[model samples]
Every structure is written in C-alpha cells, then in structure tokens.
Target chain A: MTTHLKRWWPLALLLALAAAPYSALPLPGLLDGPLGSPGSLQLIALCLLYGGLATGYDLLLGRTGLLSFGHALYFATGLYATDLAMLEFGLGFVPAALLGTACSVLLALVLGAVSLRVTGIGFSMVTLAFAQAGAILVQRNPGGYTGGEEGRSAPAEHLPDALIGIQNTANLYWIALAYLVLVLAVVHWTVSSPTGRVWAGIRENERRVEVLGLRPYGFKLVAFTVSGALAGAGGVVYLLLTGGATPQAAGSDATLALLVMVVLGGSGTRWGPLLGGVLYTWAAHRLGDLANSGSVAELPSVLRVPLSQPLFLLGTLFVAVVHLLPGGLAALPARLRPGRAARAAAPVTAVPEGAA
Target chain B: MNTVVLLTCTGLGLGALYFLIASGLSLIFGLMDVLNFAHGALLSIGAYAAWWAATDGGLGFWPAVPFGVLVGTAASVLLELALIRPLYARPRDQILATVGVGLALPALITGVWGSDARPFPQPAALSGTVDLLGAAVPVNRFVLIAAALAVLLLLRLFLARTRYGLIVRAGVEDRAMVTALGIDVRRAFTLVFAIGGAAASLGGALAGLYFGSVNPSQGTGLLVFAFVVVVMGGMGSVTGAAVASVGVGLVQQFANYYTAAGLGDLSVVVLLAVLLLVKPRGLTGRLA
Candidate 1:
C-alpha cells in the first residue's frame, strides 16, 4: 500500500521473471506444452480483458448499481473498427487498437447516454438490444468489410522482427503478459483515484451519491465509457493476436464467457479474472478429455460433443460464485496475507477496494 | 389492407405462441421474482418430450402434446425444488440458479442427442394446410394457434378468476407482505412453479410443432428473446409479456420475410435497443 513498496514491487516481479530464464528451466508440467500454448495465452488475455470489463460492469452493477448486459455492443464495435483498420487500412496493431478503442469511447458515449437512464435489469436488457443490433447489422451487410458471417480475419501485420526471429509462441506469450500487466496498472490507477471513489459511492446507492452533489448517471457514463474502451482494447488484442474476428466475438456467448470468467475468478478483483479465466479455459479444454485422452478428436464420436456444453459448467460456476464467493479471486491473497485476513472478512462492500 | 390484416393476424397467431411460452415465464417471475433464463429450455424440454413421446416415444401428436406438457411441467417442478427454492430472495442468485438449471438440461439433451439438428414431424391430423387471406397456413399452426388461444383464456381465468391467481398477484406486488397476510409463501412458489412448468411445456410443445424441430440450443435463443419480451413488455406484467412476445414474434417473422435475411435479425435487435434506450421501459413502459 505504501509508495515505496508499490514502486519496488513491479521491479521485483520483473527481476524475478528475468531471472526465471536463467534459472534451470522448469518443465511445462500439467499446463505447459503443445496444448497449453495458444490456449494459455488466450486465457490470460481473457482474464485481463474481463478484469477491465468486470470493473466497468461493477461500475454499473457493483458501483452504480446498474447491470448492463449489452456492454458487448461497445466491444463488438471496437472489434469491427479494429477489423477494418487492420484488414482494410492495413494499419499496424497498435494504431489500429488506438483507433478502434477511441471509436468505442465515442460509441459508448452514445449508448451510455441512452441506456444509462435506467438502472438494474433494464440497463442490462437495453445494452443487449444494442449488441444484438450490432450483430444483425454486421450480418445483414458486410459493407464489403465486415465479412458478414464468415468473419474478417486479422492480418498478421505487426509482428516485430525480434518476434519473428524467436519462437512465435514465446513472443505471443510475452505479448499477452505485457498487455495484461499494462491493463492491471491502468485499473489500479483508476480504482485508487478520486473518480473511482465516486464510482464506489455511486455503486452503494444512487440517491446517496446524488445527495453528495455528484450526478450518478454522468459518472456512470464515464465509467461505462472507460469500461467500453478497455473491452474494445481487448477485442483489438483478440483480433490482432488470433488473426481476426466475427460477430461471434461480440455475441451473447462471448460476453457471457467474460462474465463467467469474472464471476468464477472473482469480479471486481484485479487478478480474479486471470484466475477465473484459467479455471474456465482449463475446464473447457480438458472437459473433452473426459476419457483422459487429451484430444477431443481422439475420442469416440459417440462421446464427442460440441465445446459449448461446457458453457454450462462456466455458467454453473458463475451462479455458485455470485451467491457463494461474491468476493472472487482477489479475496484469496487477502485471506492468506497475515494482516489482511481480517480485512477480507469484512462485508462485500470493501471487496473492490482490495481487488487489484 | 391485406398486409395489415396479415401482419396483425400473424402477430396474434405468434402472440398466441409467445403467450403460451411467456405466460409461464411471467408467472414464474411473478411468483418468485426469479428471471428464469431456462424458461426456453423448459420449452425445449416440452418440445422434445412431445417429439420423443409421440414419435420415438411411441405415442402420436395428440398424445404427444400432453406428454410433452407433462415432461415440461415436471421438469419445472423439479427445477424449482432443486435450485429455485433456495435462491428466491436474491435477483442475481436467482438468475444464476435458474440459468444453471437451464444450462444443465440443454447440455444433457445435447449429450444424449448428437449436435445435428433433427426434425420432429407433426402428426397427420394436424399436418394439413388451410387457406386464409390467400396464404396457405399449416393446419398444425392453426391448431397450435387455437390451442394457444385456449391456453390464454385458461391463463386469464386462472389468474383473474382463481384464489391462486389473487395470491400470485399479491406475491408479485410484495412477496413479504403476502407472507405477512398468512399465505404460505413457499406454497405459493410451488404453485407458481407448477403453473410455470405447464406454461413452459405448452409453449415448448407449440414451438416444436411450429419449427418442426427442437434442439437443445433453442433455450438460449428463446431465453434472450423472452428477456427482450419481458423488458419490452414490462417486468412482472403478464399482459406486457404477452403483448411484447407478440410484438417480438411479429417483428422477427415479418422482418425475416421483408428484409434481407441476415439483416432482419439485426434490425429486430436494433429496433428493440433504440426503443429500450429511448424508453428504458419499453413500448409499454416495462423498465421496472
């Protein structure tokens, strides 16, 4: 919590990580290898993205007390924007990301202005309507760029010379880690700021926050915009890293996946998404190995099922955790760290404060 | 005039179906305030139940309808006992519980029945087509529509004319106050669950007939559409859900007919969004 510790902690982590390469290389073990490669990176990115989303969602659901299910609209918009930028304009990943996310901020403003008028389930439904609308628009008219149902693939435009020289997986894993770290830093800054405090106030009770002379809706819009921007950024990373996106990236399934990740790992917790994503990804990938063969393709056709059914597991996890572990993964360290156990034991109100 | 009549008739016909399905959704939500995401799944259950019973289950369509209804209604009862009972108070928890139950049945069905979409044929009695307004509508659909109307009438009577209905209305308005008034809240929930189950089953059966196929994935699509209906109509208002259900069905059907195929779904989504965002309630002010 101190300035000195905060400054040195990241450095220590960096140094420790640097030393990892020098140390006797640890085997991939249970989660290490050919299987874990793309899967692990995607899960890690997913965690960071959800961390951003859950925080944004919390701004409404947890903070402002509004639950908007349609946040995916902004996400999909950013994705489309990125899609065009990278695939059509041939922009590098970073610039394409900036443009897409910037566009999302604007789109969020328009969406938030209208939808944020009502809170709770209404907000959630309205947002969903927007997401559905966006999906339909893409489907109906590819506009020669949206790629319709087939979806637009991400052009591999930004791989640095350094990455090209090294193994591709290592480069991607590092990119995932770096982006995640960057997102954490931004979230920490926001959470600890005065604006976030108003959000905290907004979450407890709108009338109370309004009584304090701050407009809850306005702050909520700001929070929503920030959240949308981050989600957009996540979509960009997804497109750029995975190659491209379709309406699938922005559908209820994908958004629900993010929600599941947040709830399972711990919504409002900085690292909870990471933890939750790990659980979900592992469950999803390994569930196919029900017979212990490690490959879904290897399994008998009779036993084979679409990966979507595992969504049930993730969904179950969301229900269990919300009612059971409302605090999410961030609550873990608080429970373990010597003096923080007591703090973690307090009511759910302060859970967000210790999240990051 | 024909287009208008056609659309309105179509709306009413579709509305009848939505009413069948949504009534259960509304009743369940009304009684317990739990937004059952799996209401559609229950419909799927009913559809498959009817399908398997009548066809593979060795019964015919007429018999299958009741069988499916039983399957759906029973599943609803079991779901209430298993999950809904415990999470009655909290909205999020209730959402989660209902969703989990919804997810489970569909997954199990998918596991049992492969991923390929299968067709469930309407029995010969209802399979014939009828000509009206120059349109040859299916006999099964007309029967389904008539059956749906009967259901609406029954639901109306049940809700407006019965002691259970009065108690349910009271339960929706203030669950605690109803308990304070000496009604067994738990019993009310049980009744609601049964009513909801029947509605879901009937709706699912109807959906099965109309679509001629019922897949496990049907629940999620129907679930989202129902949520759109609920919010569009107004949360906890049976009338609102009924109307909104009709509205959604008409829009979806007509849009598909009129607009570019893929674009139509988008338009429906966009229309609902604009309407909701502009009027956070709905066409009928259902935000609450």
Candidate 2:
C-alpha cells in the first residue's frame, strides 16, 4: 500500500545514502568530483552534521516552542571540550567525546534552569547572555587554552587513524550519516511518545497544560537537556569533520544560522530540518566556490559585490522564505497540490507572540 | 587615583554610546514587541555613511555626523515600511526578518568596504587630550558625553511635552486600548523606528571617534552591550537606560582596567543574568 511505502521510504533513503560512499557517479554541476571522492564526501559529511544539529535544535524551537538563542553554547561546549580533552587530558577519541557530551548536558541543565524561570523573550535574552558570556570566554582564550582568535585543532595522534587523513573522509561521512540517523530515530521516538504529546501541549497552549495539573517547566527542561545533549554529540562529529573547535561555533550568529535552517526547512515537520540543513550547507559551499571562481568578477561592482558574499544571499533567501513561504520548503509540495493549499499554508509552528 | 578618574571618564563615554543604541532598542521593543535584531546593522549603516562622508564626500566631521544620521533614519524608515510593516501580524517572522537584515547588511558592508578596520578621520579640535583629575583623557570622550547628554535631554523633553510622545507612551502601556481609542498606532511605530535609527546612527558616529576606527563588525560587537543596558534599564524606560548605561559602562571600564581586559565584558553579562534572575521585571519594573 501507499501508506506502507510512505512510512518505509525514509529507511530506503537511508540505505541509499549509506551506500553513497561507494558510488563513482560524476555529478558535474552538483559537485566538483565523483560521489565517492574525498572532497565530495567531506562536503556531504559537513551537510549531514548540520542536518543533525538543526534537528536537535528543533527539539526546542519546533516541538517545545522554546526560542533559545543560546543553542550554539552547547554545540561549542561539545566542540571545545572534546578538543581540549584530547589535547590537554590525553583522552582518546571515544572518552573525549563522552566527556564533551556530558559537559554540554550539564551546562544545559544549569543554564536551562536559570533561563526557564523567565518565560518568553526573557528566556531568549537570558540564554543569549549566557552564550555571549561563553563566546567571550572562548575569545579571551584564558591562559592561552582556546588559541585566542584562531581555534585549536584536534591532536592527530589522539584521534583514530581512520579519521585522521583525507583518504578516510568516507569514514567520516559514514559517522556523519550515522549521527543523522541516530538523531532522526531519537527525535522520532520522543516526539511520538507521551512526553512528546505533552510537548505539543506546551507548544500549543502552556496554560491549558498547567490547568490540567501538569508542570510545563519540567517538560521544557527535559526537551532542553535532550536537545543540548544531541547538539553536543553533533559538535563531536563536527570536530571530526572540520578538525578543530572554532569560536564561530559559539557565536550568536551560529545559533541564528540554526534558527534559519529550522525555519527554512519547516519547523515541527519530520525531515524538513534535515533537508533544509543539507540544502543550505550545499548552497553556501557552492556559492563560496562561485564567488572565488572569478566569474562574478566580470560583472559591475554593484552586482559583483552582493554575489560574492554567501551570507547575504542566504540571509535574503531566508527572509523571502519567512515572508512568502511561512511553512518553509516542506510546505511547498502540499501547497502545490490542488485544494490542499490553504491547509499547508498555515504556519507549522505556533510562535509565542508579544512575550518580549 | 588618576587611574580611577580616567577609567570612570572612559567608561562614561562608552556608556554614552550604549545609551544611544539602547534607548532606541528599548522604545522599539516597548512599542512593537519586536526585538529589532537589525538594530546593529542600522548603526553600521550610520557609521559607514559618516565614514564615507568624511573621506569620500569631502564633508568635515561635524557635517558628516548629521549626514550619517539622515541616511540611517531613511534606511530604518524604509525597513519599517517595506519589511516590517507587511509582517505586523506575525511577530516571530518580524524578528526573523530583522535577523536576516542583520546578517545581510553586515555581509554587504564587508563585501563593499573590505573587512579591515578603517581609521576614522579625527577632527583637529577633538583629537587633543584634556587633563581630567590629573589624567590625560581624550577630548573625544567629552564630545561623546556631551552628545549623549543632549540626546537624553531632547528625548525626555519630546516624551514629556509632545502629543506623539503621549501616544507612544499610551501605546506601550496598552496597544489594543490605543487602537480602540481610534488612533493609528502604526504611525507611532514608524516614528519610533526613525527615532531609534537616528539615535543608533549618532551613537555609531561617536563610536567611531571613541574607538579611533570603524569596522563592519563594530556595531554588532557593541550591540551585545547595548542589549545588556536595555534589559537592565527596563525594556522601554529611556531614563532607566541612561542610568544603567552609565553603571554598566563604569563597571566594564573599572573591571577591565583592574582585572583582565575581557573580564569587564563578562561581568556585565553576569550582571544582566543576575538582575534578570532576581527581578525579572528589570530595574524600572515597567513592562513593555
């Protein structure tokens, strides 16, 4: 039946993506090399890593309706902790990753408790302040631990031999793919359980849930903790993909980029954030390539300048999506179908209003 | 003792800049419930415009300030009308739109101007140092303080004496009630945005003088501090912003001087967190 096919399609897609490393198909415009090439695998792995991150972030934004502006803090915590553990404490890869994830979870619990005290925009600002503090700490590189402006790279000796060189990029790609699958499975399981139903209630109308003798705070905290944990794990993978922990991962801009990804994908919908993440990462990389390709150099300065910057184009595209496509790219298919337009056009996520 | 005086003066100067940015941010958030994330971008526009005017447009520093303010105000008004007005129904979208603008404008600035910091043209009169409490303080600090004081006074007078100011205050208190009273609150929103843009742009111009150079990321870097001031001062209270700005600035200056260079910034953020956790309603206890 079509229903069974629809339900099982994700598994099929997963299988196909898992086998992508062995493919030598040359996609001319989409990538610079064949599918199995180290360069292509690296880009794909990065995209997959972000896809996982965006999905984790949606645990707060889409499911629980918490607009956290400090998600990057946890991500950065995972990144820096893993790198530092390896570099300073002489921990191997697995142990360092576990420690990093633990740190992120602990930070989320502590900060989430403080931030959740104030509802709505206050919570957002509080999280932002905390993240800003973290960013400042990293940038100051107290006692030269964080490498000041330039981030510290992972110690190659500490990492596994398979994850060290360019030839092993496919292994990294597999790790990224595994991360995405894990997140997808966890998010799918959680969002369907009883706790997930409560999250839905919290997202829709917290007052109603409270009136029914339930505590919204506890539910929200769980969501925040789990989301933070997933982000931390993603950070570990990101370190493997990129080979370092950069301060950019801790900045507010990084959080904003995640927000953009979730919104662009269609918040609250399965697979939307993943698709958006992959698409955005690909576009940004391709655009950067195009900018440096000297093609735009021939144009007038006015056109050439805007074309050269990937962020400008992405930001503008994000705004347009926010305006015209309220439900994001996920809603596009439904919108195109006859008589389903109105239903699909409605915003997928119920954003809390006037709380600032 | 002289070190303390110099630090206090410099901190106050920094606080003045914070006030300029925070006051507008407060009013806009108070009135529209929109976070206006692009506020930093507005400051950058003003700074870049003034920088261009001083160097490429052949305008002196005195004339360039007003020119920058003008351009900033125009850009903000356009943003309000074109981008923000359409999404009045969707508050979150409004914030997202501003975020987009925030990202895009800075990237545009870097693309056109390059990422390097450009030296601000110092007016001969403002470049010299003046002895303050036996500490040689830069004259530009005094200029910034004077400008902030003037703006503070003008803003208070406008809020207390003008009819538009009355509408703004009322709208902040209860927007639906103001609409029920047969008033067009949207006009006040545009006006507030304009006012905020002008103040932020002015801050940007003075910030250039204070820092001795202007860069694309300067406005955004200061924006975090401005957010601290805004939250500490209460969301919509102009007077509260002025007081908090001075407090934060002084704390940052003294802490940075006595301790680590970045510790002051960290302390200010800590202060904001503590204040929010303690009071939640801010110092003024006035809700937007």
Candidate 3:
C-alpha cells in the first residue's frame, strides 16, 4: 500500500513471484473462471484491498498501542465518496478513486486525532461508535445522496482507457498481485527503518520516548496519513470489486473480523494479515453458501451455519492465539529463518543499551 | 421524546447487561492489566448453554438464567486455567492470546451449533404487558430493568460490604502491595476472572430473554457496546460502568429514535468524534 514503492526487493521473493505465473500452475478452468478471467482478476483486486486494510490495522494496533474497532469508517468513507462522485458528476474511475482516497485520508486524520489519544479499550469504543454512526447515517436518509438502504452503483463503469487496450483478465490479476507485492515491500522497508524502530520504542514506552526528546506525534501523524491513504486506495479497489458501497461496508462485525485476521496472521509481520484474510474470506464464502442452501435438518445439520455466528469463531481464534502462539503464526516463519533466533536474541544484548 | 424514553429504558437494560459482562472485565483489567477480549465469547457460551438447557432439557427460562450463569462460571474457570493463566506474566501475550482465544473458540461454537440464532423464549408469566405512559411496555422489559438493577446493587454490596470485595478492590489498586499485605492475590485474580465470566453469562441470559432469541452473533454485537460502557465508565470502577452503560444506552436509544433511520448510528459517529476531541479518557473513565 505504499505509494512511492521501491522497485527492487530481495532476490528470493523476486524469483518466486517471477515464477508465479509459469511454475506448476493450477490448470485453468478447474472451477469457473479462467486463470486471468474478470472474475479471477476481481478476486485478486479484493485480496489486495484486504492486504492493504490489514496493513493499516497492523500499523496502528499491532505496532502501536492504538486498537480502533471502527476503521471500516475510513474504508466506507472512501468507497462512498467514489460512489457519490460517479453518481453525481460524470467522473471517471481515476479521478474518482483519487478523490475517494483523499477524502478518506482526511477522515482518518480527524478520527485518529481523536481516537489515537485514547489508548487500548477506549480507542476500540470510540472507533466502533464512529463507524456505527456512519452506517446508521447511510441507512435512514431515504432518497438523499446515499440512496438510503439500497445504495448507488457505478453505472457506465469506466475501465481506464489504458486498461481498455489490454482488456485481458491476466493483466488485471498481474497488476493486483504486483500491487500487493509492492505494498508489502514498502511496509517491510518502513518497519526496518530508523523511524519504524522509533515507533516500536513509542509502543513499548511512551514517556521514555518523549523524555528522549523524540517527537512521536510527528511519526504517528505520518504513519496515520500513510496507512490511511493505502487503506483508502484499498477501499477504491473494494469499490471496484463490489461495484458499489453501502453502510454494510461499515459494520463492526466485518471490521472486527478483519482486525482478528491481523491477529491470526501475526499482527506486526508483513505477510500475516494477508494469510489470515485469505483464509477468513474463503471460509466465510463457503460457510455462507452452505448455510443459505439448506435448513438445519439438511446435511449433518452442523454445516448449516449462518455468517454472523462465525464472529464467535473469530473471537475464540483471537483468544486462543494470544493464549498459545504469543507471537502468532508469523513467528513460525522467523523461527525457521537462518540465524533468526540469534538475531532475535541480539535484542537481549541491546536491552542494556536500551536501559542506558 | 417518547422514543428517548423507550430507548433510555431499553438502553439501560442493555447497559445493565453491559455492567454484568464488563464487571468481570473491569475487575480483571484492574488487577491483572490484561485486556480480556474473550469476555464477549464467554457471554455467548452462557447464552448457548442456557438456550440448550431451556430448549433440549425443557427447563423454564427462570431456571435457565442461573443455569447459564453457572455454565458461564465453569467456562471461565477452565478458560483461566487453560488460556488466560499462561499469559499472566507477559501482558502482550495475554492480550493477543485472549484475542486469539476469543476468535478460535467462537469458531468452534459456531461449528458445533450450526452458527444459527435460536430463540430462548421468556417464561409466559414474565411475557405479559403493562401500561406505562400510554405506551405498551412489556412486563419483560420491566423485569430486565429490575434484573439489571438487582445485579448492580448486589455487586455494590459484594464490593463494599463483603470482605472479599474489599480485598478485590485493594488488589486492583496495587497487586504487589496486596501481596505484601499477605492476601493471596493470584487466588483473588482467579476469583475475579470467574466472577467476570459469571457476570457476562448473566448478561447473556438476560439478552436472550429480552430479544426472545439467542444468536451466536449476539455476543459480538454487544461486545462493542460493552467496551464503550467499560471504557467510558473507566476500568476498576463498576459504578462508573453502570452509569456509562445507562448514558450510552440512552444515547443509542435517542439515536434510534429522533435521529430517524431507526437510530441515527451517524449520531454515534458524531458523538465519538466529539468524545475523542474533548475527553479521550471517556466522560467518567480515567485514562489508561
């Protein structure tokens, strides 16, 4: 989700990604869409959006102490902004996307300024209230701008003139996959930087960071803005995926699901949230399909599960992760990495300096 | 205005439920400083248990409430031993672990119960209506309100008048100091955790009756509202939570009423905006 993403990455990831399309691929048409069909491409676009939202969540909750339960507000704001622009004005996707991202980032700034000040549970409460309010506003307003409960769709959907030339599904999928790779690389780099280290410092001890005369607020604002913009862009992609936005886009259960996804995947790790989201989204779809098709009497009756109740599952998963895998599934990869333990242990050596 | 009154009544009942669920959470947070996210899931467990007891076992709703509380208490005791105990030393682990358990365990429940919402019908004796201010207020609503108030008052007496309550209060202030005072602080912690689970179940039992249905997702819905109450009321203060729950309940009710669109959720958004701008610590709660 980094805008000015660097081109170069480690050789391993580059080689792996380069081989993605060609190497031992799943044969086309195994299910429905071809390898690069519009459906598949749209799925990739949504995955990327999930990745970006997950990253935004991690930046605040995982890295910092702020855990806002209402981030769907920003995502919804961006989506609604895009929808409204297209409906009201004859705006193209490009300008509409940019405008959407801009408005959402501004919204995040306003929210963060307030929500971030209240750490921990208070932060969660404030954000929930904010997002719920947004959803409620859209619901009651009948024929006014938001189209009431129904919501407005993007008619005359503009696939950029540039995309029109290519028009193949594979190209769009590749583009989305590339965006995910690029965003993670940028976030990885950010975490490895001195500023990232400072953020970690602030997370551990705030009074100490202030005592050291390093202004954590500036970095926090920067982080908030960057995370907000990336999330907004992700919202645009989500808008593209669904072809519209509604107050449903701003539900607490959905947002909580996403945040729990972050925790499941490993909060601070680069790849954790993506892993979590992919698993969660897949399970959700499958479960939803099963539950809708039959009554409790059908099948094992166990399979007839509704979508909303899955939240209990999500909550339980979160609790168990904290209980057992303290570091998350993300920690497993690092444990296997060469000299990671030594590198992690190196922190023990630095503790004296940290104290000094 | 009528809407406000209606919402206030409803919100207070819900807030009372919040008090039950969050009381345990606030107590644990005060003493251990571990944010118990799984508390919501615990409430759901009680709800399901009561629902099962009432439905499959053919027990009455009145009997099911205590049954649910007991079932919730057992779950909490096990949760503390298995999930929450290990994370006691590492606060971050505790937070993440509880959150993780919160997710995975709920999944297991949904997996088992088929993830559908099933109703826990109120006893017919409590189901009749009474006239209140030219409005049709169900006898059940009054029961719910009275139940919440009764719990709150009982909790107050427990904390203020009882010996264990004073120890728990002292423990919240400073666990190490409490240990120095030679009261078994860890035992006290476990007791508080059990109490929290009990309170959560009691709330869930009430919720099932009030809604005339218990969905697995009900706990998740109440989680945020409970959090809002706990945060606004501040940690370690049950009275603050009680008051805040009523306040938020009233606010949410009014939002449901006059604001239109069946409760101006946007009003909540605006309220949060103002709250963050003004008192980030919450109206009555202290900053963490």
The best candidate by DockQ is: 2
Q: In model 1 chain A, where is the ten-residue run with the lowest total lDDT?
A: A347-356
Q: Which regions of candidate 2 fall more than 4 Å away from where they truly are?
A: A1-5, A342-356, B283-288
lDDT values, one for every candidate? 0.66, 0.91, 0.68
- What DockQ would candidate 2 receive versus the native complex? 0.72
Docking class of 2: medium
Sort candidate 3 into its docking category: acceptable
DockQ of the candidate models in sequence: 0.47, 0.72, 0.47
Comparison by DockQ, 1 against 2, better one: 2
| CA lDDT, candidate 2, residue A232 | 96
Tell me the tens digit of each residue's lDDT in model 3 across A1-356: 34324334445554554444344344442313543445545554555557657866677666654566677777788888887887777688788888999998898887677666665555566677788777766766545888777877765456464343335434444555665666676677777888888777866676788999998777676666667666777677676566577667766656767777777677766677777766566555544444555454375544444233455455656666655565567776665675877677542111111111
What pairs collide in candidate 2? Answer: none
How far residue A139's Cα lies from its native spot in candidate 3, in Å, is 4.7
Residue B153 of model 2 has an lDDT of: 92
**iRMSD (Å) of candidate 1?**
4.9
- Cα error, candidate 2, residue B103 (Å): 0.6
Total backbone clashes of model 1? Answer: 13
Identify the superior model by lDDT, candidate 2 or candidate 3: 2
